[model samples]
Target: MRAVILAGGQGTRLKPYTAVLPKPLMPVGDMPIVEILIRQLQSNGVDRITFALGHLAHLVQAVLGNGKRYGVEIDYSIEDKRLGTSGPLSLIRDLNETFLVLNGDVLTDLDFLDITRFHADQKSTITIACHKRSVNIDYGVIHRDGFRVTEYEEKPVIELYVSMGVYVFEPAVLSYVDPETYLDFPDLVNRLIHKNEQVKIYPYDGIWFDLGRFEDFNRVHEIWDDLKPKILSHE
Candidate 1:
């Protein structure tokens, strides 16, 4: 299987830490997050990996060095200009089969092979891996019918299914990508929907974290010893 790791963003949200290193290169538990991801992919049946790179591309190249260390083949697709998440895929050639695309800074135990098989079994144009997250609202939320208040809830916890920045795509879905245009994943999903293509969601209730966010980054560090075994476990 093949996988594309999106490691290009400047990681503006990470500030000083990212100022010196690319977001994917940011260390978590003594290893670069992307390196850990590479190892996970290899364990999950991915032998070929491509890095969609931009900001600090050289540093990433220097650090990962062709993926041999992880027992996977690594290549790079550097963007001349900023291509939104999905745009880089259009620039990458030879994706004539089902493939995986995900953000490099993701830390999750979701089985890559399992999702790939799920996509194939469903015969979907794209399958997005989603996770359930709860967001707590601090203020009382009022539901009104015109001017009359119908309901009110105090400090409600809202449940939402959020993208885990991982996806399995069939080659047929590439028809929606325009090589000249910059596009993000959501917009591509919308386009697929507009065209009546099948898009599916694979909901996961596993331990997952988007290390791009500072809070998750810090939390991972706090719980690394407990989480590392599971995150990197081949089982």
Candidate 2:
């Protein structure tokens, strides 16, 4: 399988740490997060990987270095200026077959082979890997009908299905993207919907985290002992 990993974000949320090191290069347990991702993909049968990079691109290339050590052939597509999430895809070439796209900073033990099979069986234009997350609301909520309160609930928990920044895409999907334009993943999905393309989601209940967030980054380190085994099982 071929995959494109998005590692270009400025990681503004991560601040000082990201100022010097790209989020993907940030250590999770002992190795960088992107290294874990590459190993996972390689073990799951992905042989070719491309990095879509911008900020600190040179550093990423320096650290990863052709992916030979990781058991995959690595290449890169660098953006001259900022291109929203999906826009970077326009810069990559030879994506004439089905491919996978995902964030490089994500930490997840999801089986790439399974998602690839799911996408193939469904014959979907795009498939997004999804995880269920429960968000806690601190404030009270109220329901009103023209200023008359009908119901109220305090500190409710809401469950939502969020994208894990992992995706399977058919090459045809690129038709909607205008080269060199700023386009985020959400906007691209909206466009796919407008065009009546088959866009689906694979619901996964497993280990997943966006290391871009400070809290999640800290949490990973807090449980590194346990996470290390599951995340790097192939290694």
Candidate 3:
């Protein structure tokens, strides 16, 4: 299978560390997060992988080399400038088949094979890996009917399923993205939906960390001892 890993982000959210290294290169446990993801992909039957690169592109290439050590063919697509998220896909060639695309900064034990199968079986244009997340409000929440206070609740929590930055795309969907300019994946997905294309979401109920935020980055170390084994185990 072929996959494109988005490694181009400047990772502004991760300040000082990103200032020196690309977010994908950030260390998690012993190996860099992207490296772990690459190994996971390889083990899951992805033989050809491309790194969509921009900021500190040279450093990343230097660190990962030809991907021989990882047992997969490594290739890259250079973004002359920042191209939002999925915009970099426009720069790659021969995406004429179903492919997997994802952000390199994420840490997850999700089975890529399952995702690929789901995409094929469903005949989907695009499938987003989703996870349910909840956020609680610390303050009391209030409901009002104009001039009257109707109800009040303390620290109400809101829950929603959010994209985990992993996706499967059929080559036909590539037409939706233009050659250049800033176009985020979310925008592209929405555009496809508006056009009545089949965009599916695959719910995930396992370990995941974006590592784009400071708290999440720290959480990796806190959970590594437990998460590592699950991620490494093929069974």
Candidate 4:
């Protein structure tokens, strides 16, 4: 199976560390975050992996080096300019069938095979891995009507299903990507949906962490020794 890992984004939330290293190269135990991702993918039947790189591309190349040590066929799609998520897809070559796209900075045990099967069975142009997250407000929220307080919800919790930065795309979806255009996954999904094209979500109930912020990075650092064994397939 083939997988495209998005490793280019400058993780603004991760600041200093990302200033020196690409977000995917940030440490997530003894190995770089992307290393775990690669090993997991390799163990999960992803034989060929392509990294879409931009910021600090040279360092990434220096470190990974064609993925030989990791036991996978590695390739790269360098972004001369910053291309938002799906925009990089337009630059990658020879994507003629259903394939996987995922964020390199993610820590998850999501079963790629199951989702790929789901995408094929549904025949969807795109399948997003979704996770349910609950956000809690720190302050009370007030609802008012004509300067009168109708109700007050004290620190209400909001629940939402958010993309885990994992996706499966069929070849037909590429037509929606215009060459050299700045397109994101959401933009592509909306276009497909508007056209009545098949776009679906594979809801996941599993460990999913994105090392995009210090809080997330710190959380993983705190628990990864125990957590890593559970999430990584190759380990």
| lDDT tens digits by residue: candidate 1, 73-143 | 99999998988988888888899888999998899999998999899899898999999999999999999
Q: What is the C-alpha RMSD of each candidate to the true structure, in Å?
A: 1.3, 1.4, 1.6, 2.1
In candidate 4, what are the lDDT values of residues 45-116, reduced to their tens digit?
Answer: 888998999999898889999888888989999889877988988888788878999987888889888999
On lDDT, the leading prediction is 2
Ranking by lDDT: 2, 1, 3, 4
Using Cα atoms with residue i matched to residue i, what is each candidate's TM-score against the true structure? Answer: 0.96, 0.95, 0.94, 0.92
Separately for all candidates shown, the number of backbone clashes (residues 3 or more apart, or on different chains) is: 0, 0, 0, 0
Supply candidate 1's per-residue lDDT for 192.
97
Off by over 4 Å in 1: none
Q: Which stretches of model 2 miss by more than 4 angstroms? A: 144-150
TM-score sort, best first: 1, 2, 3, 4
List the candidate 3 regions with Cα displacement exceeding 4 Å.
Answer: 143-151
lDDT of 2 by residue, 26-79 (tens): 998788889889988898888999999999999999999998988899999999
Candidate 3 overall Cα lDDT vs. reference? 0.90
Question: Distance from true position, residue 92, model 1, in Å?
Answer: 0.3
Model 4 residue 134 CA deviation in Å: 0.9
Best by TM-score: 1
What is the Cα-based TM-score of model 3? 0.94
Error at 130, model 1, angstroms: 0.7
Q: lDDT per model, in order?
A: 0.92, 0.92, 0.90, 0.89
Residue 77 of model 1 has an lDDT of 94
